[model samples]
Target: MAEDGAAGGRPCPICEEPLYKRHCKYVCPQHGVIMDCADTFWN
Candidate 1:
């Protein structure tokens, strides 16, 4: 699995918070699961 800020180290699309890798998804502290493995990149 990739690190917290791996390939697409982008911010949350909704709130602009730092996104962290959780399992196969990217999560924002303010928002929840933002992106998953099925998706190409973190928006």
Candidate 2:
């Protein structure tokens, strides 16, 4: 079976672990929030 949330198995950016879709954002351990990535893509 496939993993939850993501179509493939991808870890969080901050935590480098599985991403958890909490509330309305993709939360990570080290990064905390993975949202607004586009805004900081170049930064």
Candidate maximizing lDDT: 1
Model 1, span 1-43: residue lDDT tens: 4695554456788988877887778887888888896786533
| Every candidate's CA RMSD | 3.8, 5.4
Residue pairs with backbone atoms closer than 3 Å in model 1 (clashes): none
Can you write out model 2's per-residue Cα lDDT over 1-43, one digit (the tens) per residue? 3333442334765556766555445656556667633455523
Error of 1 at 31 (Å): 0.7
TM-score of 2: 0.41
Which segments of candidate 2 are over 4 A away from where they belong? 1-10, 13-15, 36-43
